[model samples]
Target: MSATRPGSVTFVAVLVYINGVLNIIGGVVILFTRDQMVRASNAGAIAGITTAAILSIVLGIVILIVARGLLSGSRLARGLVTVVMILNAVSGVILLFNFQFFSGILEILWAVVVMYLLFTQRANAFFASRA
Candidate 1:
């Protein structure tokens, strides 16, 4: 059941790690700028903003965990990454509809690339062997 680690898997893992780091930074920024954000928004929106920031932080941590698992060729990691990539792709589509063309397109492209890499024959074999 031995299998070589695929380049695609490596690329996907690297990208996931980088994205996770960015997500962590964004979440931290949101937390730090909470005061100004809360002041600018209405009373009800304040709670939503806080919740979003917290969720972002949690999401970032989860992403990092998944990425680490992926490097170890975990089957669960592949499933988790697939789910995340799908959600990201959907979000990218929504972004496009909201007129954020560039970002939306970039997001979609990145998600697609990750998805492709994960499903490659070599990647699949590597994960299966590790299982």
Candidate 2:
């Protein structure tokens, strides 16, 4: 397999680390804030929190996977990152529209960073080297 550029690998690693940290934080909040969350007892709130926690965990896993792929200079990683970024952007927009407060802000930032990293010239060069 071709080696990835150090800069690209480093960039992706940073992204992965950030995503993992956020997921862990979100998970802890969801798991620990159950009582506070339950107090509202609104089915929609409960469902939304649950969904958010689950998605955070899943996104973390995906980020790790993509990081691995990127480190190995796999072309597939670019495609995966693209898909994930698109989904994140869409979700961020939806969350903003839904007025999810802090969560919306986080999602928007996440989407922007991911999109920037994935679309940058350095990222394209890294993928090209693999080809």
Candidate 3:
């Protein structure tokens, strides 16, 4: 990879990889401790929480796969990451209104930085050349 390309693309890829790993770990922890959560909520809420945990795991795996593709400079990966980042940013906004301002802002910041890197000229050219 070119020097310019390496800085942005590599940074984004690493960030995505780390984020995916953390999400997977967090999801697994939630799934394992689900009983505690269920005890405090209704049956319907249990199902909803379980579904969210499963979705988190699934999304984490998808992010990891996308990160691998990104290392290869795949344009498809860039698009996929962009979509994920947008969704994450929206989720962050929801979290903000839920009184989790610090975590929400951090999430939003991470997504913004990754998105910015993914859209940089160097990153675009890198993927284009590989394509």
Candidate 4:
């Protein structure tokens, strides 16, 4: 495997860590707040929370896989990161409309961080080096 720069590895690792934490928090909330969540489910609150939890868990797995790929100098990880960032941005925009009822700001921040990390010069360089 080609060696990636320390900075690039660090950035991707941080993103992976964030995704993992979000997943854990989401799962805990869903499992612990079942009654409260069920009550708000119909109003979109519970549904939203459940969806977010599932998505977070999925994303966390993806992040871990991509981080491993990146560290191993796989170019596919870069493309995956870009795609994930775009999807996240789109999701954030959709969530913004429901700002009053959700963690809209956190969604926006997550999108921003993903976009920034994926599009930065370091990320580009990392991919290029792998190529």
Off by over 4 Å in 3: 1-5, 86-112
Instruction: Write model 3 residue lDDT over 35-127, tens digit each, in one string.
Output: 898676588887887888899999899889998989988889999989888998999999999999998998899789889988887777888
lDDT of 4 by residue, 1-131 (tens): 54356574567766666766677677776756755746743767766776777776676677777777766657787677667767776777777786632566666677677667665776667667777
Ranking by TM-score: 1, 3, 2, 4
Clashes of each: 0, 0, 0, 0
lDDT by residue (tens digit), candidate 2, 4-119 = 47574568667777767778678767856755877665878777778878777777777777777777667787677767677877787888898886787787787677667665
Query: What residue pairs clash in candidate 4, if any at all?
Result: none
Candidate with top TM-score is 1
Span of 10 residues, lowest total lDDT, candidate 3? 1-10
Q: Candidate 1: where are CA atoms >4 Å away?
A: 40-43, 90-108
lDDT of 2: 0.73
Worst 10 residues of 4 by lDDT: 1-10
Predicted candidate 4, C-alpha RMSD? 5.5
Once fitted onto the true fold, the runs of candidate 4 whose alpha carbons sit more than 4 angstroms away are 1-9, 17-62
**TM-scores of all models?**
0.79, 0.58, 0.73, 0.56
- The C-alpha lDDT values of all candidates are 0.88, 0.73, 0.86, 0.68
Candidate with maximal lDDT = 1
Q: TM-score of model 4 relative to the true fold?
A: 0.56
- Colliding residue pairs in candidate 1: none
Q: How many steric clashes does model 4 contain?
A: 0
